[model samples]
Each structure stands twice: as C-alpha cells, then as structure tokens.
Target: MDRSKRRFVQALGATAAMASLSVSALAARRTTWDLLIVGAGTAGLPAAIFAAGRGRHVLLVDAAPQIGGTMHLSSGQMSAAGTRLQRSQGIIDTPQEHFDDLMRISRGTIDQTIARLAVGEAAETFDWLMSVGFEPLAGHPVSGLAHEPYSKPRYYWGARGARSILEALGPLVDRGVAAGRIDLLLEHRVVELTTSRRGAVTGVAAQDAGGARRELRARNVLLTAGGYASNAAMFEKLSGIPKFVDHSYAYSQGQGLELGESVGGYVRGAEKYLANFGVILASEAQPAPLLARADFYPERRPPWEIYVNAHGRRFIREDMQSVDAREQSLRLQPLMRHWVVFDQSVAERAPPLIVDWEKEDMLAAFDSGAAYFYKADSIDALAGAAGLPPRELAATIEAYNYGVQTGNDFLGRRHLPVPLAKPPFYAIRHQGVSITSTAGLAVDGELRVIRRDGAPVDNLYAAGEILGSGATQGQAFCGGMMVTPAITFGRLLGQRL
Candidate 1:
C-alpha cells in the first residue's frame, strides 16, 4: 500500500482498538433492560449515551463491528436556528424561520409534525455537541453549500467532518459503559423484534457474527438502524428506482425497515424520492461505485458545456443558480441521467470539470477508454459513442451554436462562454443517484413507529435515517436535514425514554 493508505489503515486499527476498550462483552447482566437501541450509530450513540445517563439500563447493538454508523462517511453538515454559536457571531435566527425556510425549499413536501419536532430541539442538540468539544469549521454557519440556502447563516460542519462529532460522543459512551449503565454489542445484528401477544414490542432477537442468537428484553425498543441506500433490492422496492450507485454504509441493508414493518409498522414517502443531480460512475455496472463528481454547482464553476438527456435534448439551463432546481430537473430526465457535452476549445479553457481533478487527468480518461468519457472527431460520432441520438445531438449542437452567435439562447442560459463548434467533441456520462434512502418507516410526531391506521406500535420508536430522508427534508435535499434530525430525535428520545 502507499504511504498515506498505510497510515490511514494503521490509524483506523488504533481507533478500533481504543474503541473496543469501551465495549462490553455480549453477556447481558439483566433479563430485561429499560431500553434497547438497535443501532450504535449517529442516532443510536446519542440515544444510548443519554438513556444511560438517565440511569436506564441500556443495551446497544449494531450489525457493524464498531459504532458511529453513517457518521463514519457523512459530511457531518448540521443546520439549526437560534444556536448559541449563531448568537455569539451576531447572527439572529429562530426555529420558526428555520421551519419556514425548510418548507420553502422542500415545497411543502416535508412532514410538518416531524419537521417541527426536529427544528424545535435542534438548537439544544447543536449546543450540546458544541459543549462536548465538537468544533465547527472556521467561518462556518454559512447560508449553505451544495443544497438550497437557508434564510439565515445556520449551516455548520466540523473540519474533520463526521469524525469530529464521533470523537465528541465517544468519550461519553465510554463513561456510560464504565458506569455499568450501557452494554454495547458489536457484530450483532437484530434479526427480529420480539413482541407480546398484545402486539407490543418487548425486545429484539439478535444474531452474532457466529450466528449465535439471543433474545433480550426491554421495555422500549428504538430503531436507529439507518436507511436502505446500500441494499439494491430494497432501494428499488422502496424508492421505485434502480439503485444506481454503491455509496452507502454497508450495514445499511434496510433490516430496520423490515423489522419495523414485520411488527405492524408501515413505510411511506416513496413518492418523495429524489436523486442527486449527477455523478460520474466508475463503471457501466448497475449501482456502480462513484468515480468522481463534476462541479455542477454553477456558483462554484460556471458551465462551459451543455447538459443533454438521453434523447439529446437540453433539459435545463446549465447556469441555473439554484441547486434544488437543477436536481429536480435532473430527476425528470431519462433514468435520471445526462451527458455533459463540450468542444475542444471549452475543454481546454474551462475550469476543471471534475472536482479536485486536473484537466490532463480528465483528458486521460478518454484516451484510456473509460466507460463514461466519450470523444470523437465529429458530433455524430461523439453521439454514437456516448449513446445519444446522432441526429438530435447534431441538431442540438447546431441550435446551441446559433444561440451563441446571435446571443438569443433558447433556454435563457446566461453563461454561454463558447459554442460547441470545435472538432474532437467530448461527452461525460453523469448518473443521478442518492446515497441515502428516501422511503422510511411510518412514525407519528412522537416518533413512534405507527401502523397504516396511524396508531403507534407500543414500545417501538424510530429515529435517524430509518424515518426516511423524505420524512424530514421532504422531496428536496435540505442541508443537514437528515443528520441534524437524526441526532436531535435520538437525543430527545434518549432523554424522554
């Protein structure tokens, strides 16, 4: 391995070793605990910490070998109004304003009850995270980055991303384990939810890596087991789309959703599914690994190329400022995919198309015969190579050049730097995919997993991605909506239950 990779592996090993010191063996001391958290992740960690802090005997179980869940891969972006940090920075805000901004950005698709509950307690969550040594980036609390901007400067993230948040929570969990309040089980997956004859959830039946099964009892069971983005079958079944990308936590196999549904709970928000604008895939395989991301955000890099759909039609203005508008437009394209088409002059002069990639590296992709990069001496040949209609692509390029000459662009695009008239045309395939599950278990305002009749399943609650991205952010990619709500709800449930 290279030096950097070897160092990373060594650091990861050391971290796991230290974390293992805080974990209790798989032996449960009590037959019935006060609470059982089904995932020791972003939501489960806080839930276990606070629940144990309340002197509740808590059993924390996870399918993964360690804790922190999706936070391990998350950007760790968080948004909360009326935070002490915002006040200290002299920026005024409120949860009501946060709610309004979310509704505006999501176009009223979010669950109002859940959204309110999340925003209402988000400040406390952020403040607590800050008090525990979670540091935000310098000059943070900006309006936004890749998502729709909030009205106030409420967005923040740590310099080290989610690991910063995990570092803050790890010590508290160790204290809980040391005090004999929290019992943690790693490499144990909850296979079934044990229920009373009355249909109230009593506990969970978990299986270890060795397939040894054990039934533990608890008065309350909370599912913070994350989403199904990693499970292709479940992703298609729930979101009604092929899982086009393999970019989620491996343990996020929708087991929590299944466990919730098996015990009389229902799932919803399938219609609210939305994929990201687009990403370059490493291969042509279904659910391919992400190769690199193009700088589609016009603010960051004004487009010098035109984006065309499968039919070789320009779907939207390439220079559109709103990221949400771009994402929604991409959602309507064929298979949620598009191609960035440009000519030799634009390719040489435009800023690097791929984020953090050198222009020469991008040119090398075409020479190496990469799956998504296409290059040809003519537009017709390029279209054939990129799987676009030759005649339509030629016509589209002709019209685009005409617009450039006359300055009367049909799509009202303002950043038309050059025409696609130069030879050796190029196209890069971009696929729209989501890294988080959109459909989630049905839950009431109290976060209790509810039936189709809207009644809560007794002793069963859900938080985090198990509640679905749609539940909190609606049909839009609201910044920090998933992570913040997951942490906030986990905290609230931990304190209350």
Candidate 2:
C-alpha cells in the first residue's frame, strides 16, 4: 500500500478503538485530549500548562513518574538580553547582541533561523520568569559562566538548580490539573503514532506501567519528549557516533523521536557532535561516568595536575578560554577518554584534585583507589599500574618537568610549574563525558518537526533535546540553550498553537 493507504488503515483502526470503548473505558481504557503532549519535562510541562491555561484540553504522558526529566539535573543557566532584570541591574544588552554572540560562539554552525527566533523572544521569556517569582543569583546577567563569555552580560541562573525552573512551573501544572484543563498520565510511554490518510499525526499509542496499551486522540500531537542520550543504541544509530558514556536522564530514551519518525518526521543534525573538555572520574570503562571535574580556572583555583591521552601527550593548553575548543578536541579522541597524571609532590603541595573533596575524603579515595588512585615510588612504576607505556610516559613527564623548571612549556600550561621529580607519583584516569548530545532532529522556526527532505511534517511538532543541541547551540554549549529553549518553545506553542 502507499503511504496514504497505510495511514488510512491506522486511522481507521484508531477510530474504531475509540468508538468501541464505553464512556468510563473511553476515559480510562483510552483518552481523547485536545492536545497530546509526550514527555512532561521542561518543555512538555510548560506546554501543558500554557495550553491548558488557554482552556485547551491537554493530556501529558511521561515514561517516568516524575515530570522534571533532565531538568532535575540541569544547571538552569540561561542567556537573554533586554530583560527586566537587565534593566534593574543596569546591564545593557540587546536581542541582536544575543543572536550575534550565539552565532559567534557556535561559529555559524547553528541553524541561524532557530537561533534568531530563540534570542529574539528569550528576553521576554526571562521577564516572564521574573514575573512568576523566579529569582536569579546575585550578580547574574553576567557576560557568561562556564561557557565562553558573551559580548554582553546576559547570562544568569536560578540560585537553585534546574529545579528552580521546575518549581516555577509546578504550580502552573497543578493549577491546570485542578481546573480540569490538563490530564497527566504518568508512567505511560508512547510507542506508536496513529496518523491520518494525509500523513498528519492524529494520536499516539502509549503503554502504561501495567503493560496496558491505550490510544490517545488529539487534533494536535506535540512531541517534547527530549533526546536519546539515555538510549545508547539509538544514540549511536541516530548520530552515527559511538556513545562514549551513558550520562543522561535515564528516561530520555528518544521515544518521541522514534514515534514521530514512525509516522513521517525526519531526523537530522547528527553532524554537530562535540564532547565535554574532560571529566574527572573513577573508571576507564564504557560509560566513563563523571565523578569530579578538572576545572582549570587558575584565577579562582589552579589545576592540581595535567591531562594526557592514551599516547601520553598533553592535548590542551589547560588554560584556554574556549570550552568549545576543548570539547571539539576531546571528541576527536578514539573513545572520549583521557587520563590525569600528577606526582606526589604536586598532590601534597597543591589543593586536592577533587575540588569538593575534603582532605579526609581525598586521603580515603587515594587509600581506596576508587578513582584510579595509584601510588608508586617512581613515575615508571605508576605508569605500569596505570596501564600506560612507561618509556613514553617518562618522556612526557620529563618534557613537562623541563617546562616547569625552565619556564618554557610546550602545551602552555600556566599553573603547576613545579617539576614532578618527587617520589610516589599519582595518576587518576579521567574521561570525557556529557549530559547532552550534539545530534538531534531538525526543527524549523515554528518548531515544526521536519523530514530529511527539508519539508515539515504536517501537524507534527518537536522541541527540547529531541531536536538535538547541535541544531541550536551547534558544536558548542551555549549555557542555557537546552533547558531555556525547551521551556520557551513549549510555552510559545501552548500560547500560539
């Protein structure tokens, strides 16, 4: 059968299913909502709240019982220009500057249209948050934070983590529920989509926790279900890149993307993959999960040591201002993993390698070897235990020591000019890890889901991480692109659509 025929059959079956069920069964066996939103997260939640507040009946479904999704762990950093906060703080900025800085930071890799729209309305969204009682940290709206500095001071975060945004959204969600404008079906994962003969999405087939399948029909089907960061297999397949580590929201399984594609939506933007600079961790295994950070802001706190790959060579300036440069380099590595090597003298003389670790905790980790803590009488012995070539490792150390003593570094490592000529050398294996993906579905200015052919899928919409970080932020992380856009687009759709 043709594409239209297949959709006709599916639509007919869904219509019959809807009609055969009794009222309570129709209400419980299956549901009909004005708008069916998959993934009640930062994007999905705000969408539900805004749509339902507009008196449109909305049904919110999530695979996880909780609603926050990745926002629970997000930093909640955001960028916006010309906001009320900016006015109050006397921080001068403009949407044009925001757009220019975003493109500049991403090096024109981002979809300019999407970036333009996002930056244009971002200031309004920021003001909305302030009106809703969201407070920023002191001296917020700064030029930038961990990401590269923007041209203006327009970046800020809630004093709390991502939950701060959720907290601001929670009451609106509850109000929607109390007003009977929105129905939340938690623990239900969308598996299939039912479309009309014209290839327009009409409803979704979701499975509840009890292994029960139900149909939800709607005039509009929106997918804010997030990205495939948690699903390693799908992540690799979609992006054509190996998942170096598993470090995303466990429930972000690319469900919405899969369902949308099943109907007609096309996925794109896999070409923009980038990895985090480096991660201090406890293992060299496949999910080289993060344990701590090797933050190199010497002005605040100096780096206790340096990093080397499997070849035993430094790969970074170790003091570069460009997080993008650092991340792009790390992604080029074979498995997105690196090792941090230091000597006992540096370990004893400098601050602890793990920033948050108390002196007792550091000593315990060293004693326990939980984070590849190894002690040896010599550098070669430490290399042996750390599974690195002793000769090459020794040579690398020699060069580093020469740089430290002679003040002529090869890697331009500013701090830790001390030589590693002391006994009991230490090496902690660090890896590259991130909670976001550079690959995702391609979306247009209106946030409509599109096909690989550059055509919009009628009545199908996608937002949030499902659209991929690469499409919006490009190869670089722009602080709040992930959460802010998710929330912004979700709200925009709710009010407009």
Candidate 3:
C-alpha cells in the first residue's frame, strides 16, 4: 500500500484484517451495481452504508480526491427527536414536535413533504451516528446555537464539527469496500445520467480527473451530490442572490442538478434565497474567499451597537432576538451590506462585539488602517470616511443618542446601552454572505425526482442540498436543517430501495 493509504488505515485502527478496505487502491469492478449513488458525502455515505448492509451491491462515486464530499466543509449540526442521547438526558421530543418546531422556526415556509420526511427519519440517522461513536460537543443538544431555536434541546454535532461524522462513517464504508459489498471510487465525476428507452434511469456516464470515460450500469441511481453554491452562474440563476463570498466546497459544481435537468427533472423552491449575514472577507475573491464572520447573533452577544445599511438607516432593533428578522432586514439593503456604528463610550462599556476579539484587538484592526474599518472623531467625518452620506449618518447617530437619553427610540430598539456622542467612533463593513444552496430541484417525500407537473422521474432519486435547501430549510436557516435533512433523506431513501 502507498504511504498515505497505510497511514489512513492505521488511523482507522482497522489492523491487518481490514487494511485493503481502509486503503482505496483497488480498481472498481466493472459490474452492474444494485445501487449507484453519486456523491459520497453527508447524504450519499449514509445511503451507501445502509444499502450495502442490506446485502445490496452499492457503488459510491465522488469527484473529489477522497471520500467525505461536503462533510469536509459542513458543521455536521443535526437535529432529531427521540434519539437515545436525548432520552439519556431526559429530553422529551418527537417527530411531530420536531416537525412543528421546524415549521414554526421557518415561519411555515418549508416544504411540508420534505419537512415531514426529515423529521420522521432524523432520529434514527442521529442515533446511528451516536451508536458508531459520533458525539455532540460537551454540554450540547441545545434549543439552537447557529439559527432559530427549537422548542427542545434536539440540536447537536461533534467538537470537530462535521469531521466527527466522517471519522465515524469512513471506517464503515471502508469495511463495506473490504467485504466487496460496495465499490468506492474517488476522483470520478458522474458526468451524465444513463436512462433506458422507457425513460427509466439505468446507469451513469462518468469521467475521471485524468479524462478517462466509463459507463456504469445500475438498477437505481441516487443523486446526493449537493447544491450549486460553488457555481457562480448557477448559484445566481437559481438563487437570484449574488454568489458574493463563497466558502463552500470546491467540488460542489451543480453537476447533479444539470444531470437531473437533462432527464427532464425540473427545479423548485428557488424563491427561498436566505442570506447568512456575517462574513467579513479578508480578500475580494469571487467564488471562494477567506472569511471571518462576526458573532452578531443576539444570543451570543447582545448588540451594544446598531447595524446600518449603505443608506445610513438602522435596519432592525439592535437587540432583536429573531435571527430571521435580522437576516431578512439586512437582505433588503444594497448588496446586503451592513456597517456597525458604535461610539467609544459603547465600545468601552460593552463586552467585545466581535467574537474572541478583545477591546484592544478591535482598536488594533482600526489602527492598522484596514479599508473595511474606519474611525473618526465625529459622526460626520466617520460617514465620509466609511462611504456613507455625512448628513444621513450624522442624523442617525443624533436620533439614536436622543433615544438613549429620552428612554424612547424612534427605531423601537430596546437596548440602548450607550450612544454615539463620544469621539473616535468606529464602523466596520460586513457582507451578508452564504454557502448553502437555498433553492434546488423538485422531489417527492419519497425522494423521487419529479418533473414540473409533479410526475416522478422513473428509477431516479435525490437527497441533500441537490433537492435545494428551500425544500427543507425554508426562507430561513432553521438550526440543524441542512445536515440533518441531508442525512435523513439519505438513510430514508436507501432503505426504501
């Protein structure tokens, strides 16, 4: 075996018995697979493991250099009711409760079919992960941390985030490969879906990274290859939002959606473009850029300052609890740009606003003369330096200060801890950037790909963000929606077939 393969095998603790499976050195057998799944990722890996365990010959193909497609990028945050972990902690939750919580958190914007399926199948998927040594971070399973909160503490993942899921799942896949129940192929991109004369999906056409072509036949095909977030053109076309700062996986090229569309499958849930507002990119790279997102969530740190648009108006109350309200409010502004304006008084009194950044670090960034950060002795100068209308910005600070003294904010903001009367003010620009696919192709609750008229495309199935997060995540990011649903649908569809 190669050096890296030996190391990987040793890390998995497989010993000599499962060394071959641990190292993916065997050529994929040229045989008809009982199940052919594109993308060995959050959804595809779970699907392959379950199907292979059921005595089916599974073929799992990925275009990346190794297994674990987007899991490398995912936070692995998942939510499920009735998990044994929840029971151990005396937490009471059910699929119906989960469904209701999701609907409520999304404000009833999520697709019911997809939501129901995910809520129903989620607990088993989560339990499976835990049974295999997948663990939530210490003192977790909270109501919510990243997005909106659920009614109960049903949200979780690992300390290493999504890698925890991969660490536990990888060896199982390796064992399947070693036992010959599954064929593993990395660096093989599925280029097209092969269909029968009657329009049933029978196989796939793939191209290796070196440009070699091969056709593989299968009884059924599953597309869990993820969304078009990494594709600038497709991301804009489908989402109607600029692919501003992409921090998603590079292999997320929307190939699955293209292949599905080639077979007459239509897209759905494109109207649900939700921006996750917090990115402060260090560079101007279009598709993929290094980003440091601010910890602006109300739960993490109450706003000691106000967020303003390019027009120099406060979008939402500084201490608003609803994360959806804050995000949508930002989405309406120009380029979804927001600038935090705070006075020296507020900065001195309040806890550090940016996560892990102390009061001194905040001053250091401003002193370094970064283009995105600006400071001035007065609001007028601060506006000019930060590219806003001096009059409007000056007026905004005046009204905010008036509210602080008068005990009544014109903007209805309840938390006016300190105002902008002090000199040497601060303002930092932030972009509302996202990496998740908000829209995607249409699919039934059973995960069958469907045409525009709702007719199921024969012998084809899909899961994960390839089905668009809109179908499950809704107009907002419900905590644990993305990863949970992807794994849920993967486990559900695999067993059904």
Candidate 4:
C-alpha cells in the first residue's frame, strides 16, 4: 500500500479504538430518540450539544469512527458581527453589514434569506464558542485571507484551525453523553431514511462496518452529514464540474444529500458552483491529492509567470487583485484547468510561486517528472508536454514578451518583471478545484428540509455544508460563510427543535 493509504488506514484504526460501545449494544438501548443528528462533525456536534443541553434525548451517529467530521480538516475560519470579541477589540460591526458584504462579494447570488439568518445569529453562535473556551488566534478578526475581503475585520480563526472548534465542542458533547442526554454512535453509516406513510422522515436505518443493521426512530432527523466533495461521481453530477482534487473530509461522501433526496428533499445552488483559483495536484488523475498551491494573490507574490488555459490564451490578468474575479474567469475555461508558464530566468529570479516551497524544491519537481510539472527548452515542446496548443502557446508568449518590452499588456497586468526569453521554459499545471461541495440539499430559512414545491419535509432538517457551500456563499467564496453559517444554523436548530 502507498504511504497515503497506509496513513489513512492508521488514522481510521485509531478512530475505531476511540469508540468502545458496540453498534448492537447502542441500537438495542434506544429504539426512539427525541432528536437523531447525523454526522457528528461541525453541524451535528453543535446540534447534539445544544439539544442535549435543552434536556432533549439526542442520538448522534456518524459513519466515521470518530466525531468532529469536517472540523478536523476545515480551516475553522468564522465571521460574526457584534460579538464580544469584536466589542472587546472595539471594532464596531453589525449583522446587516455582514449580510450586505456577503451579498456584495457573492454578487447577490447567495440565498439572501439563509445568508441573512446566518449572519443575524452568528454573533451569538461565536460568543457561545468563546464562552466555551474557544480561543481565537492573537491579533485575529482580520478582514479576510484567501477569499474576498469583508469590509469589517470580523473574520477570526484559532491557531489550530477547525480543531480549535472541536476542542470547545468536544467537551460539551462528552458532558451530554456522560449525562445520558446524548447517545453517541460511531462507525455506523446511515443508509436509508425511514419515513412515515405521509412522507415525513421519522428515523434512519444505519449499517455498521460489521454489517449489523439497526433502525433508530426519532421525533426529528437532522442531516448535518456534510457535503459530497469527497464523492467524485456525486460531486460531478451535482456541481456540473469534475472533482479535480480530494482535499475534503474523507467521510464527506454525500450521505446527507442522498438521504434528503430519498425523502422528497431537493438540492439547489448547482448554478452557484465555483472552483478555487487552482492547485498543483499530486497526479493528473481526477480527484487527485493536492501537492501544493501557488500564491496567486498579487498582494502576496507578484506574478512573474503567465496563466494560460488549454487554448493557450491568457484568460485573466495575472496580477488581478480580486480572487473572485480570477476564479470566475477560470470557470469559463475548458476543464477548469490552467498552467503557470515561465522561463528559467523568471523561475530563478522571481520569488517562489508555490506557497511554502523554495526554488530548489520546485526545480526538483521538474527533474523528478512530477505529474503536473513540465520543462522544455522551447515553448512548443513545453506546450506539447503540458497538453496545451503548441502554436497558441508560442503566440501567447510572444505577445506577452512584446507587451513586457513595450510596457503595454493587453490583459492590464502591471507586474511584468521579465519576459519568457530565457531557455528551459517550465509549465506547472494547476487544476481549479474546491474542497467544499457547492450543491446541497435545499432547506428553508428555519432549517427545515424542503421539496422542490417549497414544502417542508416534516421532521427533516439540515445544517452545515449539507445545505451546500453555494447556499450561503453563492458563486463566490465569502469569507467564513460556510463554517460560520454551519455552526450558527446548527445551534439555532438545536435550540428550536
């Protein structure tokens, strides 16, 4: 087995050991639960915690061996307006402002009702985390990072990223389990949603790794089972784009989406599907592992290389400051793929293009025959190796070099450090990919799973990425929109349900 697969197996083994109760034992004890929360990660954990806190009997289950679903992998960045933290910092902000900023960044494509609800309740949700001992990084609450900047400095994350959130939530969940308010079941995948004859979701049928099947009834079923970014087939079917990389949580296999759809719940936001600028994959295979990401942000590293599509045309200004603009431009390209082309001189003199990698490490990639890294003495040879049009590649570089010499770039690029006149041209293929799922099960503002006719699926609710990243973020990635709304909506559901 390869090292990555081996490490994954080892991690699963450790997670399995963390749970002591057998599936049969747990299933035998609880025939009915007040609330059945699926996927004990970001949204489920909060739902379970808040529900149990309200003296409700909650049954929390996950296919993964342990809880803290995507939280283990998420950056854990959250944005909230009018929080104690913001107040302490004396930074005045409001939910309306947050809502407006998200709409502006998303170009008003976001579900305004959902976005408004999330931002409105975000402060309380963030405050609850802080009250529970969640610590933000020192000098945090920045305007933004990779995504478009928010007008206010409301963005915040812990030093440990999403794990920092799990730290705060884990203990509360433990307390609920200890108090017998929450029945925690792990290593069980919910295969089907058991619904009433009237089509109201009543419970779930789950199977353990040992193939032991159990049906657990519930007054309400909350599908916080996360997104389908990890499932290549489902991702492509829903997003209308290929899954280019596998950086999502391993357990995010779209169970929530499937389960919801089985009971009349429909999905939305497929049109809002958008990919990140790009990332260097470990291989050319679909859904490949991420190898490295370039610092495409001009503010971070001015571009010394030109970005070209499969047709070998410079699609966007390399020095464009707006991340959303760059991403939207990439969406129009065939296969959502692009290549970073540069000559040996630019490679040697320019600051490292790949984040965290030095020039030597990058140069080694070409020598090692890395899947996405190609080197050729001529532009035509480099184009052939990288699968770009040779004629167009040469012409594109010629135009770029002419512009560099004359100081008049057609794409309005300002940072023209050097032309591609040097020998041994290099091309690094970067595939546009998204870690979060954009298409998700449709839910009402109150967090109720709804059908295409806009009718609520009784006793069925959803929170977190299962609602789709596009629901809150729209076609653009709004800072902290996904993670923050997930926790906030989950908390609200727990309190209400």
Error of 4 at 70 (Å): 0.8
Clashing pairs in 2: none
Q: Model 2 TM-score? A: 0.90
Local accuracy of candidate 2 as per-residue lDDT tens digits, 1-497 = 24432232121121222222222334863356778898888788878888997989888777775677787777889888889888987787898887788788898888888777778888888888878778889888887758777888888898787878877777677667556676666667888888889888888888866778988898888898888887888877765666656668889888777787787677777777776766666565655566777655555666657677787777876666666777777777756667778877787787766667765676677678785666788878888887778888899889888888877889887775578888878787666666676666666789888877778877778878888888779878887777778888888988877
Q: Write the per-residue lDDT of candidate 3 for residues 1-497, one digit (tens) a residue.
A: 34454334322332323323512433445468889999988899889888988888888877776677788878888889988889989998899999888788787999998888888888998988888879899877888767777889999989888888888888777767656787766667899999989889998988875687778899999998999889999888887767877688888989999989999898888888878875676655665474466677767777888788999988788788887788888878888889999988876888887767777887888899865788999888899888998888888888888999997998787877777788888899888877888777788777899898889989899999898888777888888888988888888777878
Ranking, lDDT, top scorer first: 1, 4, 3, 2
The residue ranges of model 4 lying beyond 4 angstroms of the native Cα positions read: 1-28
Tell me the lDDT of model 4 at 320.
90
lDDT of each residue in 1-497, candidate 4, tens digit only = 23432232221222554443535456566778999999888888889889999999999888988788888888999999999989999999999999999889999999989999999999999999999989999997899868989999999999899989988887787677667788777888999999899998899999889897888999999999999989999989987888889899999999889899999998888988888999999987777899999999999889999999999999999999998999999999998889999998998899988899998999999999999899999998999999999999999999999889999998889999999999899999998999999988888888899999999999999999999988889999998998899999889989999
TM values, all candidates: 0.96, 0.90, 0.93, 0.95
Question: Candidate 4: which pairs clash?
Answer: 41-69
Predicted structure 3, TM vs. truth: 0.93
Query: Which model, 3 or 4, shows the larger TM-score?
Result: 4
Q: Backbone collision count in every prediction?
A: 0, 0, 0, 1
| Candidate 1 wrong stretches, greater than 4 Å | 1-28
Error of 2 at 442 (Å): 2.0
Q: After superposition, how far is residue 71 of candidate 4 from its true place, in Å?
A: 0.9
Residue ranges of candidate 2 with Cα displaced over 4 Å:
1-31, 239-246, 283-285
- After superposition on all CA atoms, what RMSD does each candidate show versus the true structure? 3.9, 7.4, 3.1, 4.3
